[model samples]
Target: MPVVSNPLRALAGALISVLAVSGCQTLDDAGRVIGRADLVNDLAARLDRSTELTYSADYQLPGGRNASISQSQDPLRAAYTYPGGKLTVTADATTACDTSTRKPTCTVTAPQAANAEPSVAIFADMRKRGLVAPPVVVGLLTAAALDPDATIRQYDTTVAGRHATCVEVDQLSDAETAAFDACITGEGALGSFTGTVDGTELEVALSRYRDAVQSGAFDLPAGAGLIDRRADGQPPA
Candidate 1:
């Protein structure tokens, strides 16, 4: 894993002296701060790094519901699977799978086509549908870093055999109550998170992790109907 630069850490340390240490909330002049700079900065940096890596991770949502994230680069793609459905995105196609029925069907769309089936607003759609995806947690942590009024208490724990730093943030005002808690692994993957987003309460913990993505990480449902809305109307192989 790449450690954040030294100059960034030095600046964060100075801010910590003036600010309180209850929870580490780092504010960059902009967003380029170092890892371990503060609780919030470190976590935010970890999540930001995770976006570029290739891996597959399993998560256990609140009430034992299952979810997962499979991500890879090259063409740049990812799949977020939760309970009964999944959403997969790539440079050319966006696919959403509905598995509640006897036969699962996937609807594919050209990412730039008009009236895309899954909608180009991918992250917003997942949060509205109450999916506990990792990227959403990343957003929360990133926001917390910029909140001056947010106070955090730090803790340490291990999730899926990886050590993670955890924090609980308490916001003084209603405007700042963004996230409740978040944990980040050394490799920058989200270890766990719990909070209300867009009015829905979501809680999830990492259950398993693989450093490398497996074959067929972006594969759609096996033996399912396909609705391809691309210009060519060709199905995925």
Candidate 2:
């Protein structure tokens, strides 16, 4: 199969690759480990806990009996359509509450959506609620700053009537572009290099500068943006 260029997926894959490289480094940056032991403890604490959430809707039938419909937030839990009677929910490890005594405090707040996924809104809500740890933003920004060879470019384009931010290498050489595409296409070994971090020689995969451009994914967005943003001799919008 041709390598599908999903920027979000690609970014996620890159983040996972960073984690796979060094457990310690991954914890320090991505996992938010104040200490190795603390990190281990946190993971251990979450190992056995379970969480479950279900949204239910009720309807009144011609008879006295009522009908109930429900959906579970648990990813592992399969959805089922049941008779108009009762909906039972059991907590799972992924979505369980933090405490046992109190009612499962897993709260769900639906955000007003206008084009973005509800998950994105939920993430924004979590940020507002101080429920999510801001790690990746710090990590990527830090990587961009500390890493001198970092190349970042902003390409805004419409996709399926929605605007998207396509991040890619700013000024890529032909050879670099080829290598990047090859890496993503699985044609060759993903790029890597050695660098001195804190005086220790560290082998780190070189960020693929060309991967985002390989094939038609890069061109389509570029062309669309050009056409959409073109106002030949007019003031910018």
Candidate 3:
């Protein structure tokens, strides 16, 4: 959760504290009430709503690296493939595979496991490695929606053969967000994004997107070692 140094966050913290006590709005340098309680709220809304859509998206990342996301609803299962690992979450279990070793392996954890530690650590690690998934991007937009001095402009673009609504967020007063531009397709899929989030510069684009996912999209990688802690109650190894 490392973030860029923004002297203003301290000021924001102070102002927010006062606002908490005084029930007043936080104002920016121009004395304007901060926060985009306006139309920009829809941008964040779109990203959040994307999680409910059943689709598979491939993202082209910087340095020729790539990632993909496949998700389905009703049961709410998702699989994300990053540079060296894959993380899948299902109603029944959380499965993660680390391919950094000579032989990749998957560790499975029950839904009721303590704190869901394995997936939590893996997710935090991925976030630090510049994974700008929809949820993470949503957090950035939410913060901007509250920053009065932040400037947001809207435009249109096409990604992966689909039209998308894009927004550029800049001149933010927050410490963590540097520059953010995201495109959300009509189907609620993230079309593309470029910029920094929490000190991580993430450049990603949707190469292809499909509203339907293939069978076994959530299955663990084939021919890998397995650690089943779903019932053993043992720590992840």
What lDDT score belongs to each candidate, Candidate 1 first?
A: 0.64, 0.24, 0.66
The TM-score values for the models, in the order shown, are: 0.70, 0.19, 0.74
Where does the lowest 10-residue lDDT sum fall in candidate 3? 1-10
Q: Rank by lDDT, descending? A: 3, 1, 2
Which tens-of-lDDT digit does each residue in 15-62 have in candidate 2? 334433333443324433223223222222221121122222222222
- lDDT per residue as tens, model 1, 1-237: 223222122222333343234244455432322222355555555655676678889888867688888878665777888777788876566788887687988988765433222222455555555565554554455455555555667799999999998878677244534557878788877788887776777787899999778787788877878889788776653
Candidate with best TM-score:
3
Highest-lDDT candidate: 3
Q: Rank the candidates by TM-score, best first.
A: 3, 1, 2
Tens digits of per-residue lDDT for model 3, 117-227: 121233654655546666555556656666766787778998989999887889899777797898888776778989876677788899999888988777766776888
Each model's RMSD to truth, in Å?
8.6, 23.8, 8.4
Q: What is the Å distance of residue 79 in model 1 from its true position?
A: 1.4
Residue ranges of candidate 2 with Cα displaced over 4 Å: 1-91, 94-142, 170-237
Residue 45 of model 2, lDDT score: 24
